[model samples]
Target: MTEACERPEATAGGAADPGDPAADRLEVRAAVFRGDDGDRLRVETLALAGPSHGEVRVRVRAAGVCGSDRHVLDGEWNVPLPAIMGHEAAGVVEAVGAGVRGLGIGDHVVIAWHQACQRCGECAGGKPWACTRARSNDSLLPDGTTRWRDAGGSEAFPYLAVGAMSEAIVVPEFAAIRIDPAVPFDVASLIGCSAGTGFGAVANNAEVIAGESAVVVGSGGVGLSIIAALRLAGATPIIAVDVSEARLDEARLAGATHALLGGPDLAERVAEITDGGADAAFEAIGRVQTMAQLPELIRPGGRAVFVGLPPEGQKVEIDGLLLAYEGKTIIGSNYGGLVPARDFPRIAAAYRAGMLPLDRLISARVRLDEVNEAFEAMRRGERTRSVIVFD
Candidate 1:
């Protein structure tokens, strides 16, 4: 497929100077997934178009390797291929497009994957997180086009609309939420996804209260963030369950009050620790079995928040009778029910105040070329999070 590189007409703020030939295009190194038989990522030089109207060009500093990106790699989530993957990222603004405001060059930003259309009902209703017009999942910009093309001129979609694994990217103005320059890019990268989702699940979805008990299933980055948020919410006995003891250790450091190895007796162990069941349960890994097990891990009338992204077409069978009889609730939280414009700064502030130990979430720092190794480590459950640091 071919696309023209014609610049959109500038608006009030004036877009990247169309006459300045240097501002029109850039050649950058990006990790492109071809969806070939082996499903590996290739670092290729691609042509990156400058930001269009209401967008900004960013030089990616750091991006977190997340499970959602893995799902696309593993063919569980069928996004457009020959795509640039990586959503949770931090970067510096290099240029702004027409109509852009409140952000400019050199500003540090967290790349919010979900660029909600403000006019959508959900967005207008103050729940931009649930905006009906989000197109990131389509891997295209709001205009249904991509800014990346290979040397051969084949269009490459940006995974989740950010494609942050690249050396540089162009994203919607709303997607690039500015933060304090003092925040490290590695820590800032996580606020876009894992940290935001985990914390939002507790504060918004579950409405976790002080002294309430909670259990977090899966001790990955998102799970660890849940533990930290639970602690901040004054929740007691924050139980963390994981199959890997090493991850459980990480969970403890993230503020889990009790750690339990996950297995057949996991429920019994959690019940023992919480004296029957916890007040809330968070399933951060999207395995069907674990998603089904969430209701059992919480007390009657408790909330079960699903923070992880399950493979497309996958379904879990919940006990409807038990759910109705016990007055339990199951909530699916997308992007942590976050409004990037609002929550990104709040998360940064929390990090600055030492309320969120975000640095603990970074288990490894790898270059773009070493990203596959990072994924391997993730497959072996050896990392809380691996960040790809750009030069």
Candidate 2:
């Protein structure tokens, strides 16, 4: 852990300011990213202010380093400098701001990156994932300012506003989805991102029915989650594709009936397995090369879901004429087309009932200090998911 500041409020009978009221702040150790090129994460002590109106402060316990985090680290995604990166996390609520209801300190919750502005058109249309207010990438707080400051008084932005990589974070009350205490923090953390996204891609986006054939490209965390959802939906011949043998093995454990290594002949192999093409195909790898194959992997009148996030501004060429003639559909899912408030708890229930194998998705756990190593492992596709566990 990098020390950015000495422990705060330890002097003079635990007073932050001798003459002032008790400090309403939390000092925490966090992995701070200076820029895209630097592999070294500056562990720093940072101050997190108490939650403001309509917000809640959470003491994060378990966070997953997702592919989105890698996108920023590898300069594939755009984020402000000095970002505290990590979005998929579960924690205990430490404090709730005024006007925040239904949540109290000590409640176990999952921090979602997207929060709906309930009055927005998207919210009213039941597509909260498209709410503009929930998509801010800046480091500013909800009130157009920042609540985090480092030792040098430099402002640090929380990646996607939930910055779960830190020991603590202040997010909108809606961003904190309460979970049952019976669910372990490590398992719940994934529900916030990977599980939700993957599950949503099938249940809400593709709407795959039982007995239909499905092809999932990429066997990483999200990919495996999609495969699990396909199984729950009773999809037949659930095919998993990946270049990594280890990921293919994990895919099989996640309920895939067949696992195939990705290559130039991947679509051909999938066609042979499904006897023509799958009913639905999901591209979870987020590359143009893989995304281009989605249309070819599915049969006529089938749906192709793009669950993987390609780097910003990156485009994949597709057969517009073929799609139009075949009546095939391709859709992009942001955060799995899910409303965290409504979907998270259901996913938790599914996990409890043994429908979603979230435990099998977690391959390793490390302390916050070892987060960079986790990132490397994710890049190498060595694990389905690696979590940062904070005691």
Candidate 3:
């Protein structure tokens, strides 16, 4: 008898070698969204094609439910319909396609959601994070088609090109970076996005130096990671601001020198803490008010880094004269300005060495079916990170 969850049927025009793993279709349970209905996910069986040339297939071991994933569910982001939207994940390689080297089946790997095509001008200019093709909405393979289809044969797009909320996924070989087996799948999952983004923002974007003062607004997972990175960087008087007392407590555990509840006098409180103002301030809450208030948290000639992603069309206004006369700089960081291939390993090593507190960041471990509930918990601000651990 067949199992309760039957395998997905193969798509048309696919009669290849039966013995070749790359030619076969695998059926897996995935939390899928049919559209931007903002409803809970529908657990469905999806047919996933094997990796094509320059691609690798991974059996997802752990996937993170992040704020960005919630944004996609809330229709705050412009994503293709019928999308599988989790990006932060780590797993083991199950299959490898032609022309892919240095990775083989059974290799532990972390999925870097963004895969930069080095041929792009942005990539050549040393900004792979801005690679246009890598952020495509279609989630197309290198050959310009999707590897996923629903039970009805409708195409299923992978969000951010790495829909990791599934039992397995097929991604570009470059998107799957080999990781140490010593790093647990759950810990490695955070390093893929949250850890990398937060650490990169401090180390690369803000460039906060030792003895410098920094304030991180919003004490979510990314915010806590920013706090941890600030401490590692030896930034003095690291201040964390958040509305939730529980999150503020987490911030303190993550090495925040001072934690303050956000209110009307937040700016004044930060000023008093730093004896003037911060050398740099990071806005991890994606809100117009938070983004607008960042410039006021930093002193003259200081930098304000906006690490959160506000919805499109939402605008924030700052004093142009104050920005110009004070010589303050406001910049946006994508993926914490990280080069995943080079940075993921460093982050994993940091976790292994006990320098970065990966264990503290994980608030809950869940199953794939609890993903929607996990997102709700995130919306309620109850978890720093809720990881879906697959068996």
Candidate 4:
């Protein structure tokens, strides 16, 4: 488990990063979030290093601005201040840590945030999402400290252990998944979070049957990804509900058979559209009210898949009578039931064959400096996914 991670490039003040060209140390840029100052901005001159034991140093190329990052930006989920926030990313393997296998320097890969220790009971039992060690481990180098530092000699943390918004980062080898060479970093970046989670919802959690009808609440990147998976699953009536017309249109393009503008009493509208109830319903926005209505939309014995994570500490409203009478199953899905090694490649293959329209899902692509703008766009509901593309 001992790994000698890349040393922070030698620079000024004998700082950790000495190789940044801008500051005579390692050149790194990232979208950082700070709660105390209500600060969310792009930070340049952040220094990074190569991987340590079981780690891989990635020279990040592109990172998607996912809803999860938006959650961090608003301070709903508290991350350590000065933490690099972007997680759904794609990059090149700049270096490999000791004991790292199946990857090498110069390899193009998509960054995965959830890393599991294989020996754990959750991992051995096929539920790596429930990895017991995820919450406890810091996922840093062999030492207890980090590989990144700011100009003032302050330690900086990467979010979810990936932090792909920066120029380069040292992270666990399991966080980097090799992607097809042909896919652009922008497109492949979706594999990092939006695509992987969305596709996994229907395919893995719901196991959607062909010709079954489905309703998806919220049509952002994740919601639309669910539509795409349902389409490939041969689901016939793919109804997309959203507050935004643009997202609904995106959902339609992703294979939604019908689009409904979300209104007050959304469940009532769903009941009317589906002629009493849908075969399955997906709640992607993560609001209690929206999640609460899932039972009302599904047919008896139908499944309601909760896709989005509501703000931290928010409890979902549940009606016991409706569930008991309807025999409906309400479930929360994390990372779309994603098993990275198997699902990541399958999603890439589908995208390569022209069946999955990932390129269309991108509303805008900006540099790291524009990350705040991306978050603003997400807040205003102006775009589906604003991805960060680096050089």
TM-score of each: 0.94, 0.93, 0.93, 0.90
Native-to-model Cα distance after best TM-score fit, residue 347 in candidate 2, in Å? 0.4
Give one digit per residue, the lDDT tens place, for model 2 in 292-371. Answer: 98999998998999998898998899999999999999999888889887888999999999888889999999999898
Candidate 2's TM-score reads 0.93
Local error of candidate 1 at 272, Å? 1.5
Task: Write model 4 residue lDDT over 128-239, tens digit each, in one string.
Answer: 7777677313534324557777878788888877776887777666667887879889989898889889888998899898989899999998898888889988987899
* RMSD per model, one decimal: 5.1, 6.6, 6.7, 5.5
Q: Pick the candidate with the highest TM-score.
A: 1
Q: lDDT of all the models against the reference?
A: 0.86, 0.85, 0.85, 0.78
Q: Going through the candidates in order, what is the number of backbone clashes in each?
A: 0, 1, 0, 9
Higher-ranked by lDDT: 1 or 4 = 1
Model 4 gets an lDDT of 0.78
Error of 4 at 295 (Å): 1.3
lDDT for model 2: 0.85
- Model 1 off-target regions past 4 Å? 1-23
lDDT by residue (tens digit), candidate 3, 324-384: 9999999899999988778888888888888988778889999998888998998888888
Model 3 TM-score relative to the real fold: 0.93
Model 3 lowest lDDT segment of ten: 4-13
